[model samples]
Target chain A: MKKVKVYVTLRESVLDPQGSAIMGALHSMDYNEVTDVRIGKYLELQIEEGTRDVDTVVREMCQKLLTNTVIEDYRYEVEEAVSK
Target chain B: MKKVKVYVTLRESVLDPQGSAIMGALHSMDYNEVTDVRIGKYLELQIEEGTRDVDTVVREMCQKLLTNTVIEDYRYEVEEAVSK
Candidate 1:
């Protein structure tokens, strides 16, 4: 078996309202030293078969369907796991 | 300063399509022993000042704005750091 981890985050240029709101709230709460806030996604996937060229396939998946390239950035890592 | 970490994940009841696809990919890659996969989000926010009652404020922020309570679940933690 194999495990793939994907991380997705908004592009730097895009304004993240949720992150901004959190920053504002933190400031009001006396955590007045906060500088930047960024929000992103993390995904852990378990794959069934142990195949060759897994990295290429996973990268393609991220580009073609898993993420929005225009406004979001994604990176994935694949690791082999012991079969049980 | 204070740091708030928020983790957002799809409710167990909801189907995670991206996670499913990654599982499928893993299967095709010869990792035939894999089972369940879950996907979620992570956020790191920095606050400026160190105030009292930070936990309550951060929790409220997650409930009110940092996450969508309908389909997603969120948890957060707050920590104090040395001012620079």
Candidate 2:
């Protein structure tokens, strides 16, 4: 089996209200050193043992359903899962 | 300046309904090769130029606000931000 870690974030041009809210909260909490924040999504997928190209499968999944490509960008890391 | 990438994931003992829903969707789309899916949060923080230990500050943020200690675990990667 293989494991894939996917990270998705808003595009640079997109506005992120959630991130702004968190930034405001941080400032209110005296974490003024924080200048900016971007909130995103992380996903982990466990692929069953197969000969299929895991990278291709994962990227397809991200593009098709895991993210909204119109406003978000995504990247992923794949690793071999240790058997039990 | 420094940028911290935070990944927050649900604890192994917790149930992830959203992930299960996505997995079902994938299976409906003929992605039976996928065994499991876990969904989580990703955050990026931009710290202003400061002499304070970036690692300590980032970790504190994760523990205090970025994650729910009762059911989630978080890890972070810190990198120096490129000056424009």
Candidate 3:
């Protein structure tokens, strides 16, 4: 078995309204030191087979369907699972 | 300053297509023991002033904007940051 971790984040140039709102709320709550907030996604995948090519496949998947490359950036890692 | 951590996950009933594709790829790679993959979002907010009410405000923000409560579940935590 294999495990994959994927991270997706909005491009720096994109406007993140949710992040902005959170920043405003934080400031109002007396957490004035918070200058910014960035929101992103994470995914954990469990695969059936363990293979060296898993990383490449995962990365391709992220680029093709998991994220909008024009507005988001994604990265992933694959690890072989140890049988119990 | 205060820090808020938000975690958002798809409802159990929702079909996570990206997760499913990743699972399929893992199986093809020889990691056949894997059965499931759940994808989610995480947000970290840095606040300016530290206050007791931060947690409540952060939770409200998550409910209102950070996640889709009908299809997703979210939780948040707040911590006072130590000055460097």
TM-score of chain A of each: 0.82, 0.94, 0.84
How do the residues A1-84 of candidate 1 rate in per-residue lDDT, one tens digit apiece?
A: 677777788997989998787678766765555687888878766655644466765676678756799999988878876556
DockQ-based ranking: 2, 3, 1
Tell me how far candidate 1 lies from the true structure as C-alpha RMSD in angstroms: 5.3
**In model 3 chain B, which range of ten residues has the least summed lDDT?**
B47-56
- Candidate 3 Cα errors over 4 Å, as ranges: A50-52, A82-84, B1-34, B47-84
Return the top candidate by TM-score: 2
Tell me each candidate's TM-score: 0.59, 0.95, 0.59
lDDT (tens digit, per residue) of candidate 3 on A1-84: 787777788987999998888778766765555677988888877666645466665776677666899999887777775666
- Candidate 1 segments whose C-alpha is farther than 4 A from its true place: A50-52, A82-84, B1-36, B47-84
**Which 10-residue span in candidate 1 chain B carries the lowest summed lDDT?**
B25-34
Task: For residue A42, give model 1's deviation from the true position in Å.
Answer: 0.9
Docking class of 3: acceptable
**Model 3 complex DockQ against the native:** 0.44
Fraction of native Cα contacts reproduced by each candidate: 0.75, 0.89, 0.79
- Best DockQ among the predictions, by candidate number: 2
- The sequence of per-residue lDDT tens digits that candidate 2 reaches over residues B1-84 is 888889999999999999999999999987888999999999999998677788888888888887999999998888988867
TM-score of 2: 0.95
Candidate 2 chain A has its poorest 10 consecutive residues by lDDT at A48-57
Return the TM-score for candidate 3, rounded to 2 decimals. 0.59
